[model samples]
Each structure stands twice: as structure tokens, then as C-alpha cells.
Target: MKSSTLSTLLVAKAIFEKTKSLVNSGDKYSCTAGIILLQDFVELVVLAVLDELDAGDQKSLESKSFDELLGELKKLKVPVVKSGTIKALNKQRVISKHYGQLSEPASIINYFSTAIVFTDALLEHVIGSKLQEIFLTDILKDSPSKDFLKEAIDVAGNGGYLQALALLRKAFFLSYEREYCIYSFRQQESSNGFFGLLGMLGGGRKAYPWTRNKAWIEANVKAPADYIQVDHEKLKTDCMEWGVSTVDVENFRRLTPKVVETEKGVWHLDYDTNFAANELSLENFNYCLDVVLDFLLKKQAFDDGHKWPKRVKSGPTPMIYIDKPIFERPSTTSAIVEYVKEDYYYTVDRVVSGFDVNEEFLYAHLYPKDKEFSLTLEDHIWGYLLAE
Candidate 1:
């Protein structure tokens, strides 16, 4: 491990311990601040790991945002924190700093735990005894193509879809060589000097030594797979069969302009304009990239005899609202309900038979109490307020 990597891990651990201490002290403000610092430290650790791996130059690192850095790490096959966990922590950090709000003790604790888990995993990947075991099994089997795939991922993340596609094409070929046990051969060129003199003396167009070895050797002589012919429709079907959406595949295809074969037999994008000037949507690129990467990772996990985590439930779960209040309502027609969660506030207007004016004792008598609820009704008034 590099010195920078070791120092980053130490700093992250120190901040994580400090955060735990703050949480133990029951100081919400200080705990929230500490968690924010911990998140920054975790990001630094990621950068340091990339530096240790020599994944990219400083100019490239400087151009990428934090999210892109995470993407690069994922491409390099580094086992770090999940993207969702990082996004949630970032959201909490933003709310704390910009809104001047401190998260509840429980949320703060969850954030700290997430940070610690990520830091541990990153350290294991960076400096553990079994460093080679950290990479996915597929990458290990076909190690030569790993660098090409990483480059493709980084290029795709940077919005160079054409160049990334080219890299992917090369990676596919390299991986195919491993899968099909193919070998290369060099063609002999015609000679005009001594070889020509030998040919004239032998009264033949060319002369060759029978003892010379062939250009290529294959232990298992067999026909290789036809890699040149790519069936886009079949690829799309395969992606769908692997649980990827046709919509996302189609979106990716749209961004990939058709390549044309010139008279000289060279393939190139049809457009003549500059690649940087071409309008590309980062959101679309990210969505497609996630879909592709997810499919590949899941396949790799399966090949390695590992169980992939269950797919996260999509959409949103319906919020359950209890019909009864903790205290009896004073009004029989309408009421004003106020809910507070941490520093954020929400109001619910309901037409009911009664309401409670108690500001300190109101609570929703939910059948099942959920501590994770973002908002809880704190007070209710007998009638609707004019300001509302």
C-alpha cells in the first residue's frame, strides 16, 4: 500500500471513532457535524485508493466529481460502499449544512455505521493479505481484458460513448480469445533478393526450408467463435433475459451512433464533428451504465458461486396513516395537525369530527409504531388555522 493510502485509512478511522464518541455523548449537533466529516474522510480514502492503484492521472482525477470517482473505483473492481448508502449520507450532509438541521440520534448512528462499514471494506481491498481475492472471479479468469474494461467504463462515465464503445469492442475481442482459445498467425511477405535468387536456382516462385516452424501453434486446434458478426437484436434480447430493460438498452443504442466501414476497411463513427461538442445527456449515460454494470456484476457473482443481494424494492411503499389520534379531538368537523421530524416540519389538513388543541401531547396512534418514520404528528388544533 502507498503512504497516501495508509494515511487516508488512519484519518478515516480517527474521524469514525470521534463520530462514535459524539454519538455516545448524546450531542446531536456535534454528532451530525462529526458524521459529515467522516463522509469527507471516506471520500478521501477512495481517492487515495485510486491513487495507489494508479488508476488515473491527477488531471483525470481532478476533472471527475465524487460520484465519478466512485464509478471509477467500481470499474477498477474495488469493493467499496454501495451507491445508495453514499447518496443517503450525502443527502443528510446537505440537509445538515445548508438547512442548519441536525439529524436525529438514530439517523446519525446509522450514518456512522455505514461509514465505518465502507471504510473497513475499502481497507480490506487496499491492504489485505488476499489482495487478488478481492477482484471479481471473471476478471481473475480473464485478467488481460481487465484494463480495457476499466478504460471503457471510465470513458463511458466521462461521456465519450464512441471511444468507450471502441474500447468495449477491443475488450470483447480479448475476452473472446481467452474463451475460444484462439491464436494469431503472421503472414510471410514475398522477397526479391536472396530468396528470389534461391527461387530462380530452384526454378520455383519461392523456396522454403521444410524444418521452419509454423507461424502459430495451438494445443487444441478448433474453430474459433465468429466475433466479427455482432447481432444487436440478439444482444438486446440477451440483456432483457438477464433482467435488464429494453428501454435502457434502446437508450444506449441511441447514443451509440452507427459505425461505418470505409473503402479502406476501417470502421468509424459517421459524424465529422468534434466528440466534445456533441450533445450527450449525463443522466441517460448514467442510467445505461448502471444497467450494464449491474447485469455484468450479477453475472460475475453467479459465475463465482456467490449469491447476489436481492434486488431493492422499486417505487415507494405507501405511507400508512393511523385513523385514530392519541388524544380525543376537541372539534367535531375539522382539525389542523402538525408533524415534526428533526428540524423539518410538515402540516396535514384533515376534515374530521374532532381535533385536539394540546400542542405537547398529540400523537398518531398507529397500530404498529415505526421508528424510521420521517415525520410524526406532534400537535393538533380543533380547527383549521387561518395562516394555513
Candidate 2:
């Protein structure tokens, strides 16, 4: 268990105790405050479980309201708390906070009592012990890859084969990206001198052995700008060569085409029929899961470095301002624009000319330095700021 986890659990326990004390004080105001505190404690427990599970993005979760948080938890099927229970507690909280209604003393007591039970169950599920035993036992260890695998298996068990395959693909791509980054660093370091660096920059040199073949690069890379491309076929072959079972490799290969397809022209997941019954065997899916997990774990063991390099500030660059407001209502828009000058932020305004708008789709095109960039606004509240 990390120190942060420990501290969160401790705070949750303290809040629980305080809520109980307030309820016992026999005062209406104190009891209402206790109910609110209990709600806070439940939320804290939910967050702690999410962190423990290595679930989804913490920042996204932070932005969600209480109802939204519960909805997400339902999607994840977290066993800690039930949806009905959360809604009931939230209802009480709403009455106490917004309606200026004090819950009956017995109702408040019952709410607190239910909260205690819920928190206790949640702690046990997350840490495998009650609050008191948490410090006595070794801390829980979480693996994002393993968690993803579990989620995939759970989804598959519920007959959502396509969804499960999507999760498996996610796990595969995450590991692949990390492996590609490591290979990139190694290739960059091994190159000879300035020209060697130029070869890399100009995409003249092969980063990996598969890149030695031009046809393979075109088929696998798909895009000229994709430097860290991994060929799924090659990846399957490598896994088998590295001792992954043939059946597992074949099973994975069989599913790859269905997982992604070139529709019209653009490639994307074949979501429609991918989840149809009998498309994939349970045994093969399990085997493929094992194979991917084993391969990634083996690769991870070889390179124990962090997944990404720490970002460093680049040299200063010129700034360009927007001469006219991009949106009709500036307050309602959350869009931003920037230009890239060899890895530094530069600004662009109408003065740069070439501002084309497609009102039907809420998209705009900008031509800065003869390069075209497109921006769109959809459900995004904070539309976009392009720089990078």
C-alpha cells in the first residue's frame, strides 16, 4: 500500500468516527452535519477504491459530479457500493443541503449506520481486511495491465465479446507504445553521429528490424509520420517465437482483423458484428489474454524504467495573438489555437490569412506557414487549444 492510500483510509476512518459522534450528540444540526460528513466519507472510500483498482483517469473522475461518479462506478462494476445505496444517500444529502430539511433523528441514525456498514464492506473488498488490520498487513499491490485483463475477462464473461476485445486491444497498445518508446531511445543512442541523427530525423534509418523492409513499414506504419508503429502480425510472430503458445497467438491473430478494419478508407474497430455470439471461443480468448499478459510482463521485466520521459521546458518562441474572437460568444467557447515552431509554442491570428470555416460541422481551417490545421467544436466545453 502506498502512503497516500494509507492516509486516505485513515482520514476516511476518522470521518466515520466523527459522523458517529455527531449522530450520538442528539442535536438536529449536528445530525445533519453528520449525514453530510458521512456522504463525504463514502465519496472518499469510492475514490480510494478507484485508486486501488488502477481504474480510469483520476483527473476525469475529479471533474465528475457525485451522480456522474456513481454512474462511472456502475460501468466499472465496482463491488464496494451499490448504485441504489449511493442514490439514496445522495437524496438525503440533497434534502439536508438544498431543501433545508432536517432528516428525522431515526432516519439520520439509520443513514449513519448504513454508511458504517458500507464503508466497512468497501474497505474489506479493496484491502482484504477491516480498517484495523490494514496497517498490520502488507499493502495491496495494483497492476494496471492485470486490472485491464480482469476487466476484459469480466466483460467477456457477461457476453460482451467485442467490448472485451477492445479492452484487450487497449492493453496491447499501451504495452506496445512503451516498448516502442524504449526501442526509439535505444536506436537513437546507437546511431553513429550527426548524419546518423539526421537519418533518424529524416526517417532514413530503420528503428526496428521490421522497419528494414519497406513493404512492412508501409503496411504496418500506415502513415508516413508514424515512427513508433508496431506490426500486429510481427508482434504475434515474436510472441510465438518467445515461447507464447501457438494456439494463443493464432487466436489473437484471428481476432485482430475484426477488431480493426478499413472502412471506406479510414481504419477503425469493427464494432457492429464484433460482439456477435460464437465469433470467439472462451478458451481461445482466455489463452490470448494469458499470452498478451505474459509477453508484456516479460518485456517490462527487461526494462524497469518509467514509461515516459520527464518533460523539460523548451527554448522560448514567438507568440501570435488572435486578432478577432474565434467564437461568436467568447464566454461560451473554450477553444484555443497555437502554432509549432520546432517544438515551441507560436501564435497565429487572422493576419496569417487562410481562416476557413465549415459552419455545418463547426470546424475551421487555418493555413499558417503553408501548413494546414483543422479545429472542431462538438460536445467539448473547453473546445481546444492546439500547440504541442
Candidate 3:
């Protein structure tokens, strides 16, 4: 592919992703912006395809309006399915942008669905690429959340909707529930760091140190926003706060299983009737994923260049000092899974139950070997620890 065409396709895909995030919002303004973005995506994708297929006509097409572009695509013998849907999307965009009209929040989803269907068909027919195959995860910062989202996509593609939803839920928690370094500054007894730099810039004046009372320091120094209490209720609140419609949240939660964070900052599954794995539909999975992408995208807007604190871990302690758990084990790893739900000190003895299976099996699933933060072996026993 030509570099210009490839670049245009990437930008178009990004716009498409942003549309998904925006249209999912409950806010009318966001929904209107989403409509405008969807129109831009359609135009860019068509432009990219035209540029690739017939570079000679690219300039003329670039000056064409949305309807004119469609007409030109048809004139070029390109297959343009769902023309009416595209037209309606353009009409909405025109009304919102040029005419200063607001789109109804409820109506945005119809446009989003139509656009996805049209884009999927267009891209597949023109370039053998499916719209679903394009992902926004590539543009996100490298984190475990991104990894989980990628894995969720793979799982969903393979018809593992439940597993995919679980992964997506994990991705949401990892993205939003973690601690961040906020602006923190206060007068200190010693001149150091920012104060020291300020002193050097004071025209040769020496740094002045001020000792303040504990109350003054406490009032002035900002603490890090750490370890959010995440649950199904918080997820709903977050979704609404991020502009996701209450209806969308309800739809998303209907398919998603329950998960709650413990006092120790570890998320544990709280299965209920909603854990109906067999009831998970592909359409619901897609919607849930879309809503989550919106949440993550919103966070990404402000999360750039911010330092997040790692999960806390316990120092090495003897296994013999820990108390053994007593629980019914339906499966080999069930007891260990239950044991690791809480914040336990370092020791396999704490998780060791009367019905405990081999430590290897327990460690492999509940706590993977590759995760450094999950590993807390003390006195030759696998121990539970918070993951980073």
C-alpha cells in the first residue's frame, strides 16, 4: 500500500474508534460530536480507497462533498453498500455541524451501528479488511489493561464471549482503579527538589527552609489518589460519569459477570445469576467492548505522562506462621482460589487447605508464574500477593 493511503486508513480507523467511544456517551453534545466524527471516518476511508485504486482522481475527489464522494466511488465502479445509511449519517453530521443542531443521544447508536455495517462491508469489498479487525488498542500506552483488551478481542473472535468479557472487565479495572501521582507540593524543613530549583533561580539567594506544624503540612501536601474501591455499583457510576447512557450500562452489566475489589486492592469474582456464560451473545460482547473502549479512551485523554504506583507487596515471611484455610473444594484449585481473594501475608501455608491440590496447579491459574507481583514464595511455598 502507498504510505499516504496507509496513513489515511490509520487516521480513519482512529476516527472510527473515537466515534464508538463518543456515541456510547449519554451526553447529547458527545453524541453529536460522535456523529460528526463518524461522517469524517466515512469520508476518509472512501478517500483512502479511491487514492489507492486511482491516484489520478484523488485531488478531484478530495474537493468533493460527502454525497459527491459516494457518487464518485460508484462512478469508479467501487461497490458501495448501505448507501442510504451513509446518507443518513451524513445528514445527521450536516445538521449537527453546519446547522447547529444537537443529535438525540438515543439516536446515535443507530447511526453507529449503520456506520459499522457500512464500513465493514465497504472495507471488506475494497481492501479485504474487516472493520472489526481494526483495533484502537495499538494507540494506547503499553499496560496490562491494553494486554487484557487485546486478549479479549482474540477470545471474542474465537467465540469465547464469557472469557472475553472477563478479560475486558479486568482491563477496565486495571485502567481505572489504579493509583496515580497527582500534583504534590508543600513547604518542607529542608530545601530540596522543586524548592532547591526555585532557590537556584532566585538570583543567587540561598534557599530558605521553613518548618511547619504537622497540621499545616498535612493540609498543604496533596496525597496520591490510590486504590479505588471498584465494584459493580462503582462501574455503573463510572460509566454514567463518563457519559455512557444508563441503558448502555444496564445492557453492559447484563452480560458482564460481577467483580469487586477487596480491601487489599485485589479484584475477586462475585458470581451470581449474571454469570450465565451460555447466555453471552456476540452483539452484547461487542457493545460491552465498545462501552469499555469509551471508558479507557476517556482515561487516556488525561492519563498521559502520569506515573501510577505499583501494587503493594509483603516482605518475605515464614510459611509456618500462616493459618490454613478451610473451605469446600469443588475443583482442585477452588480452595486456593478462595484463599487468595483476600490480602494475605507471604506464605503458601495461608492458602494450604485440607483439600488443597498441587501447588503448581494452584499457582499456574490463580497466580501465573510470569507475573512478578503475583509471586511471593516464602519458605518454599507459593504465597498470595497483589499484582502490579
Instruction: Residues 1-388, candidate 1: write the lDDT tens digits.
Output: 6666555555654454455457645678877787677677667767777888998886798688777888898899988666688768877788888888887877777776676567557756765522112232223345544565566667876777667655544443343212221111111123244433332332222112221112322322222221122345655655555555556555444454333222233444432355335534444443334334444443454467756866586533223233322233434233435322233222333333323443322223221133334233233222222211
lDDT ranking of the models = 3, 2, 1
Top-down TM-score ranking: 3, 2, 1
Best by lDDT: 3
Q: Kindly give the stretch of ten consecutive residues in candidate 2 with the minimal lDDT sum.
A: 377-386
Regions of candidate 3 where Cα sits further than 4 Å from its true position: 1-37, 52-54, 71-79, 91-108, 124-133, 136-147, 173-228, 231-255, 259-268, 275-279, 294-388
What is the TM-score of candidate 2?
0.34
What would the TM-scores of all predictions be?
0.32, 0.34, 0.47
Compared with the true structure, model 3 gives a TM-score of 0.47
Q: Residue-wise lDDT of candidate 2 within 221-256, one digit each (tens)?
A: 543234454455666665655544445445554563
Error of 2 at 166 (Å): 54
| Clash-forming residue pairs, model 2 | 1-139, 320-347, 334-383
Better of 1 and 2 by TM-score: 2
Better of 2 and 3 by lDDT: 3
Clashes of 1: 5
Predictions in order: lDDT: 0.49, 0.54, 0.60
Error of 2 at 325 (Å): 95
